[model samples]
Target: MAQLERFAETRTPASRVDDVVARMRALGDDWPPRDGVAVFNRVYLSVTEEVARRIHLGAFPDAHAAITLDVRFAERYLRAVDAAADGHRPPACWRPLFQYRRHPGVRPLQFALAGINAHIGHDLALALVDSCRTLGCEPADLEDEFDRVGDVLVSLEERIREELMPGPDLLQIGDPLTHLAGAWSLERARDGAWASARTLWALRDLPGVAQEFGERLDGAVGLVGRILLTPLPD
Candidate 1:
């Protein structure tokens, strides 16, 4: 409890990103090469570092809001990490990546996609609302920034699919990875997240119902992540 509070106290928005980056790098260095979470961490860390660079360059219209959204978003994942480290269970959205980290059948592409699916699908929407509360504004006010951060994810998603995709020479149409890659789309996830942020904001007064809805969303995204991370045969 004391440790968590101190971490909470000392962590600025910039430092939070740094902490996550450093932690992800450490995990990658220490964990096995094929560990699912580590694989996803490497991809996410790169994107994060890019965002931090953009933030430094004053790339966004409202830098403060952008940094807040980015940090709060990263903190959700970090808290999950801290919880898991403390022997408390992480949120359902994060369970698959952690549970399947060592599964040999899951490829790095699947790992990366599953992590994106979990983070953007579940965490992004909530992070938007969180930033709204902290910034004292409506969801609409952050639309541009949301789309901006999302643009990065969308671009990264395309490159990841292109780079990690099995070659046409080696890939059969029946390949599960081929099918899985086509099945999930980051655009759809972004659309869904926008809708969720709107709905969650509307229901903010009804905390109980909002909490239930968030939990259900987390579970549904987790199920999809688990499917994406399913081990396949060579």
Candidate 2:
């Protein structure tokens, strides 16, 4: 339960953004199977920034394509998980970090997972940009486009929050724990010791609106600290 440091005192938005982009690029070309969340978080932020910048510069086609690609990659993960639920094994194309074998109906879960992560990534990026705006940076050159993206994310967050596990009226809707119980049972039956060891790590830790954000915010912020804000070279 440690608090994240406030980003309030960061350097000007433009400088901080350059720093973020540089640090992300410096992460190099290797991708870890276990780093799906980490990698996507960085890529989404970079894409969002690019879209914002391009739209500002009046590069409409470029901005449109960038956003399209971001949604495509993220949504594809959802599709793969869906396919896996229909008796198909996960596709080899997806990173191992996302491949689920023991669980059924995991496709929707994948969507929930990726959607939440992307939401957090965008949230942090916007916070940085908003901070920049407060610092008197020129009118983002495309404030309307930026706001359009923000509005889509806001709608998506609400939709995902209501559909994914232990929804708002959990008391009436029943616990996701009960539904995913099959997943737990499968894991235990396959390997109880290992499953027992890892179950607690999967529990959701917050409630209501904050819970929705909390679902992926920690992982996103962790990346910002670990990869995006690492000390830059002189």
Candidate 3:
């Protein structure tokens, strides 16, 4: 049976999400160093962003795909989403495309979202590299992810340009105003998810999480935290 089918027999999306979060916390607790903690944190955030992006893009038939079938592929999608979400210069790309009618008010938010998206992608790329080193998975394939994200962003930007500047070459859509509105709708969702991921990560503590993952390690998370947690023995 497919992986989703096997998972469906035992648990729902809510349960699966909980399990994943718990696993993240445990993994964090097990690995204590700064690099290890960073890796664990990025993996969790990357998976979350990937799931959100897939859902937004209709890559799946429905919401269930977010929690079910796509669970295993989150890391791959994370890389894809991050790559496309970064390297966008709205003024250069969107301005010409929109005939220089750039809305200054929304530009800041757009840039902010782009920045957040890049950070997410960068973290995921780093984590993938670390995982390849430590876990012996197939090579991280960071280039592929970067290319995928760049392609999507460019495509979407072209689509937006066409919508805004409907010359003889650029055909009309449902309605120029409505189309821009709708395009921004997807942008908002993507931006919101990026923001949420940042907030969640700030609130979480990775060392505690690692301990949960590697419960067997003596003093596990504490061992790493001790030096930081206490002053040198005088």
Q: What local distance difference test score does each model get?
A: 0.84, 0.36, 0.36
Q: For residues 137-162, what per-residue lDDT tens digits would candidate 3 score against the true structure?
A: 33322233333433344345444434
Model 1: residues >4 Å from true position, as ranges?
Answer: 1-16
Indicate the TM-score of model 1: 0.91
User: Which model scores highest in lDDT?
Assistant: 1
Off by over 4 Å in 3: 1-8, 37-40, 46-61, 74-234
Where is the poorest 10-residue window by lDDT in model 1?
A: 1-10
Q: Please provide, for model 1 over 21-102, each residue's C-alpha lDDT reduced to its tens digit, 9 standing for 90 to 100.
A: 6766776697777777777777887778888888878888888888888877777777776777788889999999888888
Quote the lDDT for 84 in model 3.
31
Better of 1 and 3 by lDDT: 1
Candidate 2: count of backbone clashes, pairs at least 3 residues apart or interchain: 1
lDDT by residue (tens digit), candidate 2, 163-204: 533444443324443233222221112132122112222332
